[model samples]
Target chain A: MDVRHLSLPELREVIRRGQYTGPTPGLAPGYAQANVVILPQKYAFDFLLFCFRNPKPCPLLDVTDVGSPVPRMVAPEADLRTDVPRYRIWENGVLKAEVTDIRDYWRDDLVGFLLGCSFTFEAALLEAGIPVRHIEEGCNVPMFVTNRPCTPAGVFHGPMVVSMRPIPQEQVVRAVQVTSRFPAVHGAPVHIGDPEALGIRDLAKPDFGDPVTIRPGEVPVFWACGVTPQAVAMSAKPEFMITHAPGHMFITDPKDEELAVL
Target chain B: MDVRHLSLPELREVIRRGQYTGPTPGLAPGYAQANVVILPQKYAFDFLLFCFRNPKPCPLLDVTDVGSPVPRMVAPEADLRTDVPRYRIWENGVLKAEVTDIRDYWRDDLVGFLLGCSFTFEAALLEAGIPVRHIEEGCNVPMFVTNRPCTPAGVFHGPMVVSMRPIPQEQVVRAVQVTSRFPAVHGAPVHIGDPEALGIRDLAKPDFGDPVTIRPGEVPVFWACGVTPQAVAMSAKPEFMITHAPGHMFITDPKDEELAVL
Candidate 1:
């Protein structure tokens, strides 16, 4: 099956039936893929406020109507329960299950939030001749927990997590220029060259994801990661929550260009 | 006193003390002024969602803690009750009173919202050499209600209200380019050239504010106005509401450049 040529809806429909469950790095090439966060109706206001307060870490793309699995703005007909390739169920902040669909766990009070992911900007960077080490190394991007505390909202507060890439000394400015266009995603690098300033003690070992090799002329650049909200959720220990499993995101109809500034 | 050279807190202090009641056009010079909206907690979520849905019309800058009267993020020391030069009170969609302070009406459940005002972009436009007709005419910008309905959120639903400015044909592109930088304020032109496209019947007679002269070679450019939330609040007619009267706005500490995307 030549999935590369398939349309967005066609690709999602295939995932909904439990036939496909894997990383969605290159699928649906030009469309935006979003990080998913669903919480009970009681927590909706705080979660939404949290995203508003910290736009860099959590750039909200679309929010589903309360109790409705459909994200009307991003994907009107797509069902959140089944359309996503994989979902992680969390109970009181503990990961309880990793499954293909959350139909059985669905409740009427759940509110889903789709946040912008980094895939769009990474593509732009690659197109501009900047090398992405994770994609080249065939490993997950190196992620670390920073000491910088996110501006807290009601019942949600924690330090930020950042993804690191070693950019060549000269391409650092170009990398910043490229990523700054997509503030809907993680935006530009939060820290460059100095890990200790972010309370990161080691570059070789990250708290999450695999660490990539740093070439001779490269300097470490860090960006606010999407894992921030999840880490905050874990710390808060909300009664119930659901999220898209790592790299298995929800694809939206809007193109990456729609989110760009220039 | 030279109010233009006065600091933000000092200007706000003057307003708080009832020493100033005039429109704040050039006051506090480079600082961002905000459109104030105070609604009961019962309506905050839907109202915020409404703002989220219609970003151009209602670009939110800061939201105060419920009943706090303190906008922590924007100006930690500024008090909402007395900082704005003038305020309009509405009860069940009807204009009730105009007040300098609302200490008597203060409620434990009220939520104050600070929305981006066009002063930020207008400053940018003037700096970029684009002539703003209303400013040149020394009159309030003309505003019209459109046939297009805003994406409704709960009980808040109404047509978009746009503020019009006649721009020279040569400067239209520059106007768009200049304003596009400040998305926190009403970003870019929603419509240009034809008023009929937005269902605006006559340019001379606006639903709100004074009409300006459109030169022979000028095109009528419309922007999503900050008046939208006020119009919608009137339509929804909740138990009680409060807003800054016409041209009297609350000023924030951040400069015009702080709100810019680039």
Candidate 2:
């Protein structure tokens, strides 16, 4: 099925029916896609603080009211439990099951947080005529667990994770300008060049997503990735947590243009 | 005393020693002044979320680790309990005391949040040759509680409060441009003209702070004030809260230019 042609509600309904369980990179082209993180009421405070303290890595999009599956701000009518294309069930920070829907695991005291994803910014980059190597190569954007540790909050503490993209030397400044407007989605480049600076050994092999080729004269530009909190969630080992499966993001009604500032 | 020449540490030390307990507008000319909010760990999450959801009204600068007296990020050596010129002690959301020091009320479970104050942006406005009537008339900036309710988070909910500055019709665009660079502060104006649109009846009679003269050929520009979350705190009525009193603020080491974006 060609999901790219569907509207926001149509796409969500398709995912809700379990008819589409795929990554959401190219779907709903201009709309914002979010990283999902749901935790028990006990860990909600610490986790929420975690996002506030580390905004570049965890730019928040919308948060659900306590025990409510609805993301009241981003997509109120949408049911988070079943709308996302796929869900990851983690027990004590260990991924135990990947489910098509999380209705069975829904709890009375869970708080849902939806964070801004880089897809919105990536679209901006592509529109500005800047090449997104991963999109060009049809691969996941390369992600690395940086040595830079995130500021800890309560029980949540871990190193920051960053996603890297290659851009020609002339386009680096343009890339920064385009992304700077979208601070809600990993803003500007954390590091412009040199993987060794971030403690990454090889550009060809990423710790998380698939790496793309860096063409001649192209430098790897690092942007704070939404995946940092997920990694932290696993390392901190909360008793229970739920996250969107890799690349299966929760789509929101807000357009990419709305996320831009200035 | 010529307090204007004092460095950040020096100014803070003088404030801590109780030698200075007055408004901090012109004291540290280039440094950033912050709105202080101290809450019990239980209410910290809701308050932080309130700031995140309403960025214009509550642009957070630094949030300390839970139960800590130090603002680790902004000022590590600075003790939040006594660093500000004055503090307001609240019980069940009602102001019970305004003191220079909060040592008697300091608790182990309190979390300190430093919110970016408008001083940074106002300084920028003046540097750009845009007039700020309050400063010209030697009074407090006029503030109004608008009809727009902040995006409620947890138990915290209240209308947004805005500080108004009348700018020449020609300089209104310049005012927005200058403040836009400082998103870390309250950023750009939320409402430009027509006080009644925000449900504010008399622009001359403000809900808080003293009103200033609006000369001819000028339109009142309203920016989301940092005072907002404080209003929310009182109305939300958490069990205990501490904040900076009136114009007294926490001055930070970072310069005004450092808070600018892009």
Chain B superposition TM-score per model: 0.96, 0.96
Clashing pairs in 1: none
lDDT of 1 by residue, A87-164 (tens): 999999899999999999999998899999989888888988999999999999999999999988778898989999
- Taking the tens digit of each residue's C-alpha lDDT, what string does model 1 give over B1-262? 4577777878888889988887888898899999999999888877887888888999999887678898888889888999998999999989999998877788998989999999899999999999888888888899999988898877999999999999999999999999989889999888998889989899999999998999899999999999998889778998899999988999998998999988
Per-model CA lDDT versus the true structure: 0.89, 0.91
TM-score of chain A of 2: 0.97
Query: What C-alpha lDDT, on a 0 to 100 scale, does residue B96 get in candidate 2?
Result: 93
User: Which ranges in model 1 have alpha carbons more than 4 Å from their true place?
Assistant: A1-5, B1-5
Quality class of the docking in candidate 1, CAPRI style:
medium
TM-score of 2: 0.97
Task: Give a tens-digit lDDT track for model 2, residues A164-242.
Answer: 9999999999999999999899999999999999999998889988979999999899999998988887788988999
Clashes of each: 0, 0
